[model samples]
Target chain A: MKAITVTNPDDPSSLELTEVDTPQLRDGEVLVKVHATSVNRADLLQAKGNYPPPKGASEIIGLECAGVIEDPGTTGRTTGEEVACLLSGGGYAEYVAVPEGQLLPIPEGYSLSEAAAVVEVACTVWSNLGMLAGVREGQTVLLHGGAGGIGTFAIQLCKQLGATVAVTAGSAEKLETCRKLGADILINYKEQDFAEELTGRCDVILDIMGAKYLEQNLKSLNVDGQLVIIGMQGGRKAEINLGALLPRRLSVRGTTLRARSVESKAEVVRSTVENVWPLLDDGRVTHHIHTTLPLADAAKAHALLDSGEVTGKIVLEVGEV
Target chain B: MKAITVTNPDDPSSLELTEVDTPQLRDGEVLVKVHATSVNRADLLQAKGNYPPPKGASEIIGLECAGVIEDPGTTGRTTGEEVACLLSGGGYAEYVAVPEGQLLPIPEGYSLSEAAAVVEVACTVWSNLGMLAGVREGQTVLLHGGAGGIGTFAIQLCKQLGATVAVTAGSAEKLETCRKLGADILINYKEQDFAEELTGRCDVILDIMGAKYLEQNLKSLNVDGQLVIIGMQGGRKAEINLGALLPRRLSVRGTTLRARSVESKAEVVRSTVENVWPLLDDGRVTHHIHTTLPLADAAKAHALLDSGEVTGKIVLEVGEV
Candidate 1:
């Protein structure tokens, strides 16, 4: 199996395509021939030694992949079924072993590359916004970095749940993209103060920037508002005035999907298939693929993401199995 | 009307008993001849000018009072009925005006001083723990400052709700008191590291010390744990690592009962009347009053509270109205 392996974590360029043995199947696992994978910010962090794969997970680089199941383990499902797997690691490989529970049948009418984008974004959005934050209809939600991968998916999901979506982006072009994707309000963070431009408080603030927007993000919340922080593109430390949080009954919750336990991840996958897959199958929610690069051009994909020019998910097509 | 006023933000000695005009009642308000009033930590903050009364509320001390309704304007409740009222301010005086909706009828056998203690703590605990956090039976709950007014009530209420209650206090004496109040586990924080000593994770952690316990409190949480912070006794600045929170799906919420809107407070009062009042009436819950000082001795009461010697609520007893 040819995989993107990290020999050292010093630099992003350290990611090497090396021939490695195929992973052996565990009791509840399935082997899949990788078709495609996507780049997430966490991938960059892992490349730079800032983040590591969860204990006992594969040392390979991908967090998600769409592939054909080679072995469904004890499950009676036939081989070569189209599926997407939420991997702890090893998604950037020719073949990977995934927990059968974390594997979802590719949605009807969607190709394998499209499903690659779905697993990561669906699992992330469903767990954070839908399950953790309890986002409901008629509520107001603010998505920071709204034109980015997670933000785009979060906007669509919140909109599907009947929420009024507000977004903060760095450029007018990004803001326009978010608006086209059902964002009701857009704040160009480069030009406008989101804390001031936002007229009323939001019921939920999904933040990617950590410290730089902490105070203003808190100020933007309504009573009993929930702040779900999934990324820290900004600095990490901030002077938090708990006095400010108390008066509004605000909650600050920080989470990342990468390190969750297998059982927890299985639950997220199950719930996502049950609740969100229907929307995808019905064409109510669509995946916004920014650009697809051939798997060998992985460096180009990384460079594109590094430049921050991509509006949505960047997929790496691994060729037909 | 005689009331306790803070002439300056300093020590308890700065509290002065001064004669002020009785507050006038407005539409949807009730004027009560305050028979008893209880001191909360917020009142101490107000005394030190760290916390100010909400806008349009009296610039006086005291957050809750129990007395006979001298007049109920516009709303049709009988005058002279014994009631407990949640006030934004003005409970220190001979008379206080409160919204008709904020008044709850005194339970049959509870005294005015007992009701005074019940109003603030009951409203605070029931709203934050039960209503907001949705703490259920068989769940573990950690109560910080577990011998104080809110703690006493929380220990009882959480026990009544069938939760296993763990508490942290400063002394063996306070821990003993909490045990009698139905706290199942007690950690003398002065002697032990609560985060290290707590072998089991809690479903809900009711925290009073904000930044001081942020990291450890998060460590003490189980998957999907809720950390409700209501005070900032340990200072407000802390380095929050969001990465630590995501895998466990933990939520850190800070809330204050005072300065909330009338509608929200009314909802809390109504909830207490419905859910908690039965427990109080049935003796399943006990209001722990540490000491009652004369209205003129409010300075002494504040001084005693400042010393942190009082185990539970401190009430100010006004003379016969």
Candidate 2:
């Protein structure tokens, strides 16, 4: 089987396409013949040696993929079923072994490429913002990096949950894209100061840039508001004012889904299948695909993501099984 | 009527016992002839001008008191009811007008002085740790300043709720008192590093010294742990590593009950009356009153709290009605 491997953790350019033996199925696992896989910021971090895959997971790049079941392994399902798998690693490969619990049936009416884009972002947004932050109906949400993969999906999910969605993106084009995706408020971060323009407080602030926006994010929160931080693209450390957080009864939470335990991942996947997959099937939520590259050109895919020009998910279309 | 007034917000000795007009009751208000008022850390902050009474509350120092109702105001309850009122302010005076909703009947076996100690700490711990943090049975909790008023109450309440309680205090004497209050693990913060000495992670960290323990507190939490900070005895600002918080799925929340709105306060009071008062009634929870000073000796009471020698709560006993 062909796969994208990180030979050295230096930069995205280090990603190489190489031939590797298909992964062996383990108990409670399935062998997925990858149709398409999506790139996440976490993959960039992993490639740069900043992040490591969970223990006993494949050291390949992708975190999510849409594929077909070659063998059900220990999972109760039969072979040759359509599925999308949330992976700790190995999604960069043609055939990856995954725990059955991490695999979701491709929702009706969604293609494999679209499902590939939907799985990682939807799961990430739902687990971090909806479940952890307890973002409720009629509450306002502030999404940072609003035109990116996670931010795009977060805008849709928050809107579906009856929240007023506000987004911050770098350019007018990205801001317009977010607006068309049902964002109630869009701030071109290059031109406007989000903290100043946002007069009212938000119930939840889903942040991708960590330390850079820490102070301003806290300032933008309402009393008892929550700031759910999923990424630290800006920097790692910042001065936190404990006194400021007290009067407003604010909470700051940081989370990542890729490195979580299998049980935890299974729980998130189960919840997503129950709540979000239906929304996708009913056309209430849609996946935004930026572009697709051949599996051999995973390098170009990563470059597109690194360039920051891609509005939504960037996928690698592995050869059809 | 006589009351202790803060003539200036600088010195603790500025608290002066002076004759003032007795408070008049309003609709749905009760006039309580003050029997005893407890000193909280907030009182010290109020005295030092670091904390101020919430808007619409009297510009007085006291937060909780136990006394007989001289008049139930227009609510039509008979006079002379033994009650403990969670006051917004004015409890330092000879007479304080309390909302009917804020008054709770004194537990059958508890005396006025003990009940005075109970109100402030009970309301503080229950609202922050219990209601907000959702502290559950069998989880580990770390309570900072565990011999102080809120700490002592937190230790007892966490124990009663079937949690394993670890407490950090300044001295051996304070640790001993924390043990007496049912703390399972006692760490002398002066001698031991709580983050290092604690072998297991805490499910909830009830912090009073905010910035001082921020880093160590984040390290001490288990996955999905909650750090509930109620005071900033430590400096207010410090460097926070949001990266450290992400993988653990931890939440850091800062809350203060005094500055909360009346509706919010009433909600807290209602929750306490429903969930915690029964424990007080059944003698499952007990209050520890360190000492009592005459109303004129409020400065002395402040001195005691400021000196940090007193364990449990200090009360200021006003004259008879």
Candidate 3:
């Protein structure tokens, strides 16, 4: 099996396409022949030696992939079935072994490359914005980082769930992308203060920039508001005004997809398949792929995201069956 | 009607026993002849003008009272029914107008004074720990300010709900009180570090100390722990490490019972009556009142609470009906 391995974690050029032993399938795990996998901020962090995979997880770079079930090690599915999956660090390879529960059938009419992008953003948005925060219909939700992979999917999904979506993005082009995805209100964070610009306080906020946006995010929250923090792209620590939170019944929940128990990841996948799969099958929430490159150009994918201009996800395609 | 009025916002001695006009009952409201009421921290804050009553609420300074219904304004109970009520304001008065929804029948085998102590603590604990946090059996909950009104009630409630309760208090005597209420672990905040002394991480924390304990509370929390901030006895602001929180899947929620809308308060009241009143009736959770004083001596009660020696609640008893 060929996989992307890091020679010097501190260097972007450290990632190299090299031959590695294929992972053996553990009990309740399945071996998948990966068709494609996408870059995530987690992958960049892992490459930099800042983020390590959880205990017992594969030390590979990617967090999600689309693949065919080569060996269903446990019960659920048969060989040769198409699937997309959330992963705990094995997706940067031709073959990866994962717990069967983390796999989802590729939605009808979607390409494998498209499916690779879907599970990561779909599960991230659905779990954080939908499951944890419970952003219901008719309520308002403020989504930060509106042009990224998670942001693009989140805007469409939140709108589909009957919420008034407010988004903050850096560029007019990114904001335009959010607008096309049914974002009701768009704020160019570089220009306007989201707290001041947003008319009504948001019922829910999906925050990626952690400490830098903490206070303003709190100010923008309506009574009984929920703020779910999945990514900390900004600084890590900030002063939280508890006086504001208590009176308004505000909740701050912090989450990550990779470190969670396999059962929990499975539950998120199951529901994402049940709920967001249909939206993907139709044209309502299309995959927003910024660019695609062959797996050997993993270094290029990292550089593109590091430049911070990618509109959505960047995928790495593998050799076909 | 006689009530406690603050002559000067800065002076604790400003709490004066004086005659005030009887409150007129609004639609779906009930008027009660006060038997007794309890001194909560909010009363002190309101007396000092540090905390103001919510819109359209009484200017009088009390939160919970026990009384016989003088007028059941719209429906539910008849006049002369004994009830303990959660009030927006006006609980300090001899006569108070409350929405019918906030009224809870006095549990059998308990006096009106006991009932007065129950509603405030019960509603606070139930709404924050039970409802919002969803603390279930087999989970461990760390309760700060375990000697205070909410703490004492929460310790027993958490115990009755099959959770192992850990508590932190200022004094050994207060910790002893918590022990009797089935606190499985006790950490004297003045002597030991709760973060180090606590045997295991907490699944839920009913927190009153705000900024001062925020870091330590996060440390004491287990993976997926929930810290519910109902009071800010410490300071209101603190630095939250989103870095630590995201990896652990921790959630921090802030809430207050007083300023919530009538319908929301009613929902808390209804759930308290349904879930907690049974525990009270069965004697599994007993109301813990440190002392009961004459209503005219509210100044003395406030002074005692300010001295920070009183364990559990201090009740103010009105003159005979």
Candidate 4:
């Protein structure tokens, strides 16, 4: 099996396409021949030695993949069924073994590479926006980083839930993409202040820029509002004004899906398949792929993500299953 | 009607016992002839012109009272019924007009003066700890300011709900009082560091020190724990470490019950009467009073509270109803 490994651990150019042994099946686990996998920010962090995989998981970098079952270990599914999976690690290899419960059949009529992009965004949005923040109908949602994969998926899902969606992006092109995704209010963050534009109206805010936007994110919140932070693209430390927070009855929750227990990850996967897969199957939500590259050009994918030029997801086609 | 008026906002000595006009009733409101009223920290802040009453509330001090219903308005209860009430203001007067929904029947076998202390502490604990933070059985709760009204009420309520309660106080005597109230873990905040005493174990934290304890309170939380801030006694600004908060999956909420809408307050009152009244009736929860003073010595009551020598609560006996 061929895998993408970090040879230097200090530079983006350190990735090497090297031959590795196939992973063996554990109890209640099945092996899958990798078809395609998408690149996430966590992959880049792991490549640069900043983020480590959870204990007892594979040391490989990928977090999600779309593949076909090769060896079914005590499972009901037959051989060669196309599936999308959420992995703790080991998604970067040619063959991977995962818990049977973490696999979901590809949505109707979607290609394998497109299904690879669906699992991460679907589970992230479902767990944070739907389950944690409890986004409801007739409420307003303020989504930051509106051109990214999570942002694009969240905007469409929130609209599908009968909510009014607001988005903040850095460019006209990005704002246009958000507008086409059914965003009700669009603000160019470089040109307009989001807090002033939607002060005292937002019921939930899906935030990515953590410390830099904490104050303004709180100011944009109405009473009984909740702000869920899933990324810290900005710096980590910030001053908080409890005086403003207490009187407004605000809630701030910080979470990430990468380090969760595999059981918890399986729960997220099951929920995403049940609630969000139908939206994908009916054409209400679609994949937004920027570009696809061969698995050998893994370093280029990291560079493109760092440049912030790509909208939506970037996929890597591994090989024929 | 005789009321306690602030002759000068700067001096506690400026509160004078004098005659004032009785309040007129608004729609959905009832008038009560005061038998007793209790003091709160908010009353002190209002006297010093630091905290102002909410809009449409009376300018006089006092937050809770026990009295006889003078006029029932449209309520089902007849006149002259003994009731414990949570007031927006005007509890310092001989007569007060309150929303009929805020009225509670004095618990079985409790005196009027004791019931006066119940409304403020009961409503505060039930709203912040039980409702907002969602404290449940078998979880651990860490409460700050263990000697005061909210803490005393919270200890008993948490114990009744099968939770393990932890408390912090400034003196040995205060800790002893908390122990009798069913606090399982005791930390003298003056001599011991609470964060070191209970790190990564608290399920919910009911905090009043605000900025001073923000970092420590967050450290005290276990994974998926919640910290609810109800008062800002320590300070109003602090630095938050999002790096620490995100990975642990913690929630921080800031709330205060005094400035909420009448409809919202009615909902909280309804929940309290339905869920908490039974405990009071069964003798599982009881009011703790430290002293009683004549209503004419309202300024002396304030002084006793400021001195930090009083334990439980200080009641002002207004007159015979």
Candidate 5:
């Protein structure tokens, strides 16, 4: 099987297309002929030796993929079933083994490439905003990186949940993209302080910047508000005033989908499929693919995503669709 | 009516018994002729002008009292109902007005003073452990300030919930007290590093030390663990490593029962009574009162509690039982 492997772990740009042994199917796992996989920030970290796959996970570099099962091992399932997978690793390959629980039916009418792009973002957003924060009607949600893959999907989902959506992006074009996706308040973080603009108003905040926005995110929340941190793009440590949190009944939660156990991943996949698939099928939420490239160009895809200009997801086509 | 007033806001020791007008009931309120009121740490802060009562709450000090209803305002209830009242303020008086929803039935086989001691602690522990943390059988809970008012009660309640209880206290004797209350693990905080002793073990932590233990508390939680901060006895600011929180999927929530709305209090009161009162009725959980003093001795009671010599609660007997 062909896979994208980092030729030199020290250099993320050294991603190379190379021959690797096909993954063996473990019990309750199925071997999938991967059609498409998407790039995530964590993939770049793994390529640079910063992020490592969880123990017993694939050493390959992708968090999500879409394909058809080639061999249904141990588990009683027919081959040739189309599925999108929430992967711990091993997605940037022609063949990947997926635990049964991590599999989701591709949304109705979605191509494999589109399905790949939405799997990670859909599960991440829904798990945090829906499962953790319990975002619902009449609430206000502030989404950081508003035009990015997770943010774009989160904005749509929050709107679908009957919430007022606020977004922070670096430029007018990104903010415009968020506006088209049902965002109610748009703040160009380059010019305005989001915390000041939405002071004590948001019921939930989907934060990616981590420590840099920690204080501001705390300040932006209303009484009983929750801040869910999924990434630490802007560094990882900051001073917190626990005093402020008590009187306001605020909660700060930190989570990573890739770090979750197989059972946890299965639960997230099941919930995301149950709650989010309908919206995608109905076109209420749409996949935002910035670009798609051949699997061999995984390095280029990583570079493009790192440049930070691309909106939504970048996909790498691996096998026959 | 006679109430304990702060003779000098600058001096918490200046509590004096004085004649004051009886409280006029607001709509949906009931006036209670106080029989027993318990001294809480918050009362000391209020006397020192540090803690202010919530809007529309009484300006006097005291958070919990057990008394008979003198007047059931417009809600159409009979007077003379024996109730354990959760109050915002004015408990250290001959008469106090309480929102009807904040009333709890006196636990079976308990005296007025015993009932008063359990009200705030029961509501606080139940709201955090039961409603917020959802502590269940086999989970591990860490209670800080073991043998203090909240800790002594929480230790027993966690046991009733079938959880493994760990506690951190300042002395060997306090730890012994915690062990007697069914704590499975006891750490003398003065002699041991609790985080080191319980690293990645606590499913829920009821914290009071705030910034002082913030980092350690974060380190001591298991995956999917929740740290509910109900008090900030140690200073309020600390540096947090958000990076550490994500992979473990930890959450930190801060809450003060006094800061909650009357409706929220009602919900908490209702839930506590439904779930916890049964434990009290069966003697599975018992109130621990260190001592009871005449209402006029509130200043002395506060002094004793502040001295950290009193375990359980210090009750101030306000009127004839």
Candidate 6:
């Protein structure tokens, strides 16, 4: 099987297309022929020797992919079924083994490439906003990185949940993209303080710039508000005033999907499929793919994502149908 | 009516029993003839002009009291109904107006003074551990100040919930008290590091030492653990490693019951009565009062709690039932 392997971990851009052994099907797992895989920030960290796969998971670099079952393994399932998979690792390969629970039926009309782009963002957003925060109607949700993959998806979902959506991005174009996706309030973080603009108004905040926005995120929340931090792009440590939280009944939570146990990922996949798949199928929520590249240009894909100009997901096509 | 008033803003011990206007009941409220009120740490802060009552709440100091209804204004309830009330303020008076939603039935086989001691602690512990943390059987809960008011009650509730309870206190005697209350693990904070002993083990931590235990509390939790900070006894600011929270999926929440609105308090009161009242009725949970004092000795009650020599609660008897 062909896979994207790190040639030099010290250099994050040293991803190379190389031959690797095909993944063996573990019990209750099925071998899938990966058609497309998408780049995630975690993949960038893994390449730089910062992030490591969870125990008993693949050492490969992708977190999500769209693929077709090649071998059903010990689980009783039909072979040749097309599916979108949430993976711990191994998606950056021609062949990947997926636990049965991590598989989702590709949304009604989605191509494999589009399906790949939706898996991580869909599961990530829904798990945090829907499962953890229990975002509901009449609530105000603040989304950071508004035009990015997760943010774009979340904006639409929050709107569907009957919430007022506020978004923060670095530029006008990104903010405009968020507005088009039904964001009610847009703040260019480069010029305005989001906390000041939305002070004590947000019911839930989907934060990616961990420590950098920690205080501001705390300040931006209303009474009984929740701040869910999924990524730490800005840094990782900050001073917190627990005093600020008590009277307001505020909460701060940090979560990562990849490090979760297989059972947990299964639960997330099940929920996303149950709740989010219908929206995708109905076109109420749409995938935002910034660009698509052939799997052989693995190094170039990493560089493009590193530049940070991409508005949404960058998909890598691994195989033809 | 007679109430305890702060004689000097600068002096925390300047509590004086004096004649005051009887509280007039608002719509959907009830006026109660206070029989017994229990001293809370918040009362100490309120006396020093630190913890002010919530908006529209009484300006007097006291959070929980057990009394009989004198007037059931607009609420259409029977006058003279014996109730345990969760109050925002004015519990130190001979009469206090309470929102009908915050009233609780006196626990079976309990005296008015005993019922007063259980209100604040039961509601605080249940709201945090039961509603917020969703603590269940097979989980491990860590209670700080284990022999104190909240801790002693929480220890028994956790045991009844079939959870393993760990506690931290300052002395051997306190730890012994916690053990007698069904705590499985005990750490004397003066001699041992609680985080070191319980590292990566706690599923839920009921914290009072805020900023002081913030880092250690984070370190002591297992994956998907929750730390509910109900008090800031140890201070309120601390540097948090957001990195530590992400992969482990930890949450930190701060809450104060006095600050909640009537509707929210109603929900909590309803839930507590439905779930916890049964425990009290069945003798599965019991109130632990350290001492009883005359209502005029309110100043002395606050002083006793502030001295850190008291365990459980100090009940201030305001009138004969």
When superposed on Cα atoms, how far off is each prediction in RMSD? Answer: 2.5, 1.8, 1.8, 1.9, 1.5, 1.6
Better of 2 and 5 by DockQ: 5
Q: In model 5, which residue pairs have backbone atoms overlapping below 3 Å?
A: none
Off by over 4 Å in 1: A7-11, A14-16, B6-18
Candidate 3, residues A1-321: lDDT per residue as tens digits?
Answer: 899999786685688888889998889998999999999988988898889899999988999999898998876789999989889998889999989889888888989998998889999999888788887899999999898998899999998899999999999999999998889999999999999976337999999899998888888989899888988989898988889888889999899988789988999988888888899888788899999988888999998998889998999998742
- Write one digit per residue (lDDT tens) for candidate 3, span B99-143: 988988898799999999888999999998888999898999999
Query: Which portions of model 6 show Cα errors greater than 4 Å?
Result: none
- Reference-based lDDT, each prediction: 0.87, 0.87, 0.89, 0.89, 0.93, 0.93
In candidate 4, clashing pairs total 0
lDDT against true structure, model 3: 0.89
Please identify model 4 stretches exceeding 4 Å from their true place. Answer: A74-79, B74-77
Give me the runs in candidate 2 sitting further than 4 Å from their true place.
Answer: A7-11, B8-10, B24-27, B74-78
Task: Report residue B139 deviation for candidate 4 (angstroms).
Answer: 1.2
- The TM-score of predicted model 1 comes to 0.93
TM-score, one value per model? 0.93, 0.97, 0.97, 0.96, 0.98, 0.97
Point out the higher-scoring one by DockQ: 1 or 6: 6
Q: Tell me how far the alpha carbon of residue A299 in candidate 3 is from the true structure, in angstroms, after superposition.
A: 1.4
lDDT of 5 by residue, A201-281 (tens): 999999999999999999999999999999999899999999989999999999999999999999999999999999999
- Evaluation by DockQ, superior candidate among 4 and 6: 6
lDDT of 2 by residue, A16-118 (tens): 7888888988899999889999989888778777788878999888899998989888778878899999999999888999998899989889889888998
Q: Report the TM-score measured on chain A for model 5.
A: 0.99
For all candidates, the clash counts are 1, 0, 2, 0, 0, 0
| Residue-wise C-alpha lDDT for candidate 5, range B1-321, written one tens digit per residue | 889999886788999998889999888999998999998999988988989999998998999999899999887668988999999999999999999899999999999989999999999999999999899999999999889999999999999889999999888888899999999998998889999999999999999889999999999999999999988889899999999899999999999999999999999999999999999999999999999999989889989999998889999897652
The worst-scoring run of ten residues by lDDT in candidate 4 chain A lies at: A7-16
Q: Write the per-residue lDDT of candidate 6 for residues B73-152, one digit (tens) a residue.
A: 99988998999999999999999999999999999999999999999999999999999899999999999999999999
